[model samples]
Target chain A: MLHRGRIQAQGEDLEESESWAADTPPTWQEGIAMIDKLENKIPKKEADLRREAFEKARSFVTQAGENGGVNAVVQKTIMVKDSKEARVDIEVRKGKAFI
Target chain B: MVQHLFKDFLKNKRIYAENVGYWQSIVSELFAPTQIKAEAYLQTTFANGEPFLDGNPIFHFVVKKLNKAVRIVQEVAESDKLEITAWISNTELDEMEINELVIVLQLSEESKTIALDLIRTWILNDETVKNTKLKIKEINLTEEILAH
Candidate 1:
């Protein structure tokens, strides 16, 4: 019978244990710290994107669609789709279900 | 002279009328892509609420927020009235396109509702419709914020 204690006693087990240590994700507290680091840069990034989006949206609404007249939007519907192929693929796979 | 004044009034009325309908459609659907299902995602994967904001797909290539998309999600959890502000644009590979997006939602409802408001704010702020009144009493979803 292969005893579990015998494996742990082996010198090779030391290397296996080291590898296991390397595989661990950050600790919960460390993870929170990582999240904080990632989050710190988020606002500025998103703000820039927001500004660009506003410009794009405004241009589309005015120059591209001016013929419809402002009142023309009454009948229009809003459908959001990613222009990037990768993003579109993600949406298609996820089917708009969050997570 | 009276005819000229009438024409001016009609033009103004037409602009406001058009905006009114656009706002209605916006509020009706409200937070779309981030439907009620988002709450589940937040609870499970995204820092319990801190999903970065910039990665949202409401904007395509010009803005990428993949690794940092949880900030906005976390902000909503921390507060009640936070604004997202993004664009919902679509074009035919730099050809024909449409970028009309208007949204209104009660931030205090759910994650989906909050996301809807944030993204909608960006769409609603389009310069073309910026001058129009944003409220009509016909269907007051929230207070009187409806775009007129």
Candidate 2:
């Protein structure tokens, strides 16, 4: 689901060893410290592009989810934001229900 | 001059009747939009407590432009009434979007009721809201206080 919020895992299914997230989510101070550390890694221009990509991805997900069901796979990668030709093809699992 | 006085009284009544008809037309003109039906998109997606799916079309218009989703969502969680609390989310929105939404919300008593129900359901059922501490507010839009 394309959700707008600080992304966080909800369930306990993620194994601590496999997951990059801290077992106990960081405090506000720690989160800020982490962002500060990673600030140099992300370019300012790329941030805008990334934000646009996220929004586009969200829209793609929403339309696909509604017309078909939840089961979908990311098919290809393209960089430009305005490509109407850029489509995320959805494979609807008709007989199987995920919920 | 009793006849003259009665004629003057009749003239005054005629003026009053004309003014009443004119004002009644004006009032109906003002309220005409409210009688029109809600947009089909809104009716299908949001009305009647229909499930607010992840990629609902409304999200494309409202939430996509949200520079202040966290703050707005938090305020909604704390609102005494969901729609009233949502009024503040307008601050984050451009004027055009707000105007469009206002028309929808004010269209009819039925639209307002449906919208309020949708807001209440959407907030309570939101997946990201794991914080049990965040209290669910009732439908009271009169008092305006920003919580958080």
Candidate 3:
């Protein structure tokens, strides 16, 4: 599965490559139109996968937000240990502490 | 730097040290999520009657607002990325809030250093400051399991 910025260890690359090929630098309006077309063209399964990924990202953030006080929630990265496991790293704004 | 800027601004305005805590409390409270409305609690003056410091007051106001919004999201979602589409203000208010905050908070050397460091961390961490985007990647499955 081709994830946000990385190629997942799966046969997802073929479809992802095709989508990437279809993508071109677009003007503002063209960009909007392109997004519309892409949204329409994407397979339901692929769309579901993307939505799941987005939700996962959102969940990590939500958890950080709940726990973090004034600190801002940053990024979370998951390192896959194997097909059934991974490690999640979360970054948050520590803010400047004045002594 | 914020402290210095605030101190200098206060000095210039001839505000008394007795009032410093009050102002700080105001700033901090404004940033609190529970503070839905922040009315001017009190406005007393020093004997000198120097014009209120040129910038810090308003700057504090805006920062407090942003902080409040951030706090609100943090309280509600716990771990969700926040994309604040609209708040109580428009683009003009947003721009002014950010600009004033940068200028006022950057005025004092200490405040500048602190603000810069905070800003650097915010950027490096991919966290939003005033009006930017933020993304949180998922935790690895192993870490989640371990935590449990």
**Across residues B30-147, which tens digit of lDDT does each residue of candidate 2 receive?**
3355442221112112112333332112121223322222111100111123122222212213213221121111112332344334333333233223221122223222212322
Please, what are the lDDT tens digits per residue for candidate 2 over residues A7-80?
11111121011111322322333323333333223444443434543344344334433443222111111122
The TM-score measured for candidate 3 stands at 0.20
lDDT of 3 by residue, A4-79 (tens): 1111211123122111111222122332333344334556554444443334433433332343311211222322
lDDT for each residue of candidate 1 in B34-105, tens digit (9 for 90 to 100): 422111111111222331121122121111211111112111122233222222323111122333232322
Candidate 3 chain B, which ten residues in sequence have the lowest lDDT sum? B70-79
Question: Which parts of model 1 are misplaced by more than 4 Å?
Answer: A1-99, B1-55, B58-76, B84-94, B100-148
lDDT-better candidate, 2 vs 3: 3
Fraction of true contacts kept, per model? 0.00, 0.00, 0.00
For candidate 3, give the lDDT of residue B71. Answer: 13
For model 2 chain A, the run of ten residues with the poorest summed lDDT: A10-19
Candidate 3: C-alpha RMSD to true structure equals 20.1
* Candidate 2 error regions (>4 Å): A1-99, B1-39, B42-99, B102-148
Q: What RMSD does each model have against the real structure?
A: 22.8, 23.0, 20.1
Error of 2 at B10 (Å): 63
Best by lDDT: 3
